[model samples]
Target: MIDTHAHLDFSQYDTDREQVIEECRRNGVQFIINIGVDFQTSKASVDLAEKYDFIYASVGYHPHDAKAMTDSIFEEIAQLATHPKVVAIGEIGLDYYRDMSPRDIQKAAFIRQLQLAERLKKPVVLHIRQAMEPAFEILRRHPGNYGVLHAFPGNAKEAAEGVRMGYLIAFGGPITYPNSQGPQVAASLSLSKIVTETDCPYLTPQQFRGKRNRPDYVRFVIDKLTELFPRYSRDDIVRITSKNAARLFNLPVDDSPELAYMIGKSLYLNLTSRCTNNCYFCPRNSGFHVAGHNLRLNQEPQEKDILTAVERYSGYNEIVFCGIGEPTLRADLMISLAAELKSKKLPIRLNTNGQGNLIAKADLPSKMRGLIDFVSISLNAQDETTYVKICRPQFGAKVFPEILKFAKDCKEYGIVTIFSVVDVPEIDIDACKKIADKMGIPLRIREYASD
Candidate 1:
């Protein structure tokens, strides 16, 4: 796990800073990006980074101290940012809730640091509070800068907008608070756009709230994330959030493609990255990541390759023929692989775009009678027009009816068939639910993860 934001330089940890950092190392905290709020703290952050190979620094002026910023101080920050261990420029932005600095001064300081980060080609760590509108407006005017909205203080729509503008929304201790909006906002955005941070020596997790926040306490944040994303495991949260921090900070970490991944005891196989529809809300357009695993495959896996990948694991509730792509595109391979896996007595589920029959020119569901126990078909729209508008299938206007027919065929073959819809703005959930009810099939509403 990576604690993206921390402040060990604070006097709160003066007596046991080394012990806290050592505990973080033993608790699997891979990296920590110590933040600087002023000239002295920036130098202390640099000192910490230089002392520990696993620690990195981000130099900038906090909005609370914007009034104290001068040209020379800004230049000092610019110089510190050039250090190899200094990965980003931040702990900067407007904080109207405090109003410690004049709003105008805060704005000017924010813009200057933003310009510095842009010229330096480094990502930023924003700390906007009640001044989200102005902060976001300033960010819009000064485009081409990307980073995280640290300790994000906005609604789900704002989070989506930040992601659309190439920024990540970070959630920390507040997420674990009762009735907090963090879980809802986290659920609404793509896993790829979410990162975990402690804002340590500040927002402590609920389990240890009121106590000083430590880097190792980041695990509590991950625990809350697991509840928000029930499909993902604790380890998935660790790897995914760590990867997000690494990518943003250019930290050294392994980010290879995953062929087979586990999510809540089910092993999902990525047979291909090829898809039948180019849905507007699909993550493929931005990044082929689903539940934190990179599904962007360089090559489609063969039958033996798939078998070998699964052989290294056991105790899965089921094997899912699902990835960012339509698994049925490789129909024969899926059927053969399912037949072989059936011998192990574990059930197999297939998640598809429901164009299997159209693609194969055959009743594909009938062939998978005993092999597939459950099948989820993407009934993404209530009608053909909506389907065409959202899915934009290569097979054109005739795809929707065929998908319904495919679902019907699967039910007739004794397979548990279900209809699924992504809850995007374009989709009519009530209409889709009516269609599923009329057909006596269950409809599963999937949250739209904005890219």
Candidate 2:
């Protein structure tokens, strides 16, 4: 994971600085960006980045050091910022709490630095204290400069302002503090605009609150975040935040197309939204995506389009023809791509409303024999009338019996068959499970939750 903010240049780590970094790597801390507060520390931050492969630098002036700024210092910072290791301009902004520098001087220095960062085409890492509104007023003048709000100490309104400006909200030890507003703001905000940091040698988390904070302890910050963001799993938090960090800093990251995405070991292909049935419990009623992926098709994907999406990966457990739509709508494309996909020596699963036989009209079950290893049919309700009421299939009252027949045909043709049902409050769960059991098919119940 990337620790987007830290101050390893401070004198606090003089004796065991190297040892602290070693400990960081051992604890799986991948990258640490050391921030510069002034010219000297900025130079030191650069030296640190050049010395260690895993470390990077950000060159800028801090508010507390604003009084010492000079024309010459700004020129030197400009030169230091040109270093290839430098990723951002900051730990810079207003600090009314300390007033170490005159507020006027702080304002002037902040604006100049903002202008410098804009000229350099680099994002700024903000450092705001008690001067939130004033600082926000300053930031309003500089639009289209995306950055991170380091160690955010603002309320939800302030947080919204930062997000509106396209800035990412960063939290550290303070977020782990008891009764803090950070977690609430984090919960309210989009996960894609959040990042993690340590601000190391300072702002230690609750578990190590009294001691000097290290890069390795960013884990505690992430842990606290998970407790507050219970809706997202730990891996989801990591993947989303890591992607955000990579995007902001131009770090290397992995991505998949919206049309094809991974969940666990399976790669799911969303071809189209054209389905034979419109179930009330279907997630497609609310959105075209699932698990934060945008599955809405711009156009129905062809065989070549699917090949472009799925052929890049090698280790996926299976290629699933599961979308918010009916994969049977493009059964011909599935058949066209089957031989090449089968050559990959990986099993393929198709998820549908089990109306492929009706959609294809001529020997679909037999044609699909060797191509598909498993078929997951959406047999949502138990009886014919209930199925019609829930599914509202275009195939009419005969559709329920046809789905059962399709399942039996798939099983007979040497393919594994499974039935899936969404547990809408009024649906009979036991009854659906019993029907699946009688048909010798496994039942998997899907839970409906708010996005």
Candidate 3:
């Protein structure tokens, strides 16, 4: 997890800063960006970043402190920004609600800092308050992934515009509170541009509401967000939001492969683990990895959850429901999900062991008329005896003939059916091709190994 906004340089953490930083590390908080509100705080943030490799710094003057901004201080900030640890030029912007600094001074500081951000090629962390209109106007004038609207107060229109200009929207601790618009706004925004932050030493989450907030508690904000956005799992949120942070802040995040990732123009779903056959060449035997993606899901994804994963990586050429397992075990889910994805013109495909007839305890092939555009069945063996010996299906000898019937019925339904084999030692590819020809459908020979 990444804390996109925090102030570890503040006095509140001075008592036990090292311990807090260590705690953040222990709690799986991989990175933290300490934000500076003025020259002194900015210097302190740089100092913290220099001390810890995982901590980055963002330097700028807050609108509340705009009264203190001057030519020399601005130049000092410009110099401080050159520090290698600095990643952005904020928490800067208008704060008319507090009126701690006059509107004109705050505007001047905000505009100057934005110009500095553009000059430095760094994203800006904005702090707009009850001044979305003016902030939007200024942002419209100076744009391009401008930065996150830190602790964004509910403004759907402004949030949409910020996303359009390639800005991210960060949700902090306030979203965890009951009866808050922050969460509603978060639900409304594109999850692609959303990130989570702690805003440490302020706006602690509901469980720790009246206390000092820490970077680690950013997980609580994420947890609340997970509750608000039920479709997204914790891992999905972490991966997607982490990607957004890395893109905007240029974070050097890890490039670990996905358990279900895009290959070419397709998105493959792999949340299912239950399968009927235990083929000798089962890919799961190889560290549960498939095409570099770890297909071992912690839990089976619900139908809606599958759609959620699709939506996260949507707009692919097609969505394929195939993994290390027999996808037909969740035949109902695949059918319903395919029906839903079809409306979006996503063209759904399902690669299975052709055991749907047995699992549903009824004829299942023709049931997939409008639900799926394509179906591929694993036909590792041509005859029942060889199939029982190699595929080792739990259904025993009868399973192979049932698979053949399933493929034939699928072809009759005009579902663009195909049969494929893994090219193991004892399998007869020619025999499988002959069966495919006789069945009036095509046969595909899948690669035996990804490497």
Off by over 4 Å in 1: 154-165, 177-192
- What is the alpha-carbon lDDT for the whole of candidate 2? 0.85
Better of 1 and 3 by lDDT: 1
Model 1, 16-43: lDDT tens digits are: 9999998899989999999999999999
| Candidates 1 and 2, the one with greater TM-score | 1
- In terms of lDDT, which candidate is strongest? 1
* Structure candidate 1, residue pairs in collision: none
Predictions in order: lDDT: 0.91, 0.85, 0.83
Candidate 2 lDDT over 79-197, as tens digits, reads 99999989899989999998999999999999999898889888899999999999999999889576999999998888878988879999888888888888888877767678999
Q: What is the lDDT of candidate 3?
A: 0.83
When 2 and 3 are scored with lDDT, the better candidate is 2
TM-score of each: 0.92, 0.66, 0.63
State the TM-score for model 3: 0.63
| Candidate 1 lowest-lDDT run of ten | 285-294
State the TM-score for model 2: 0.66
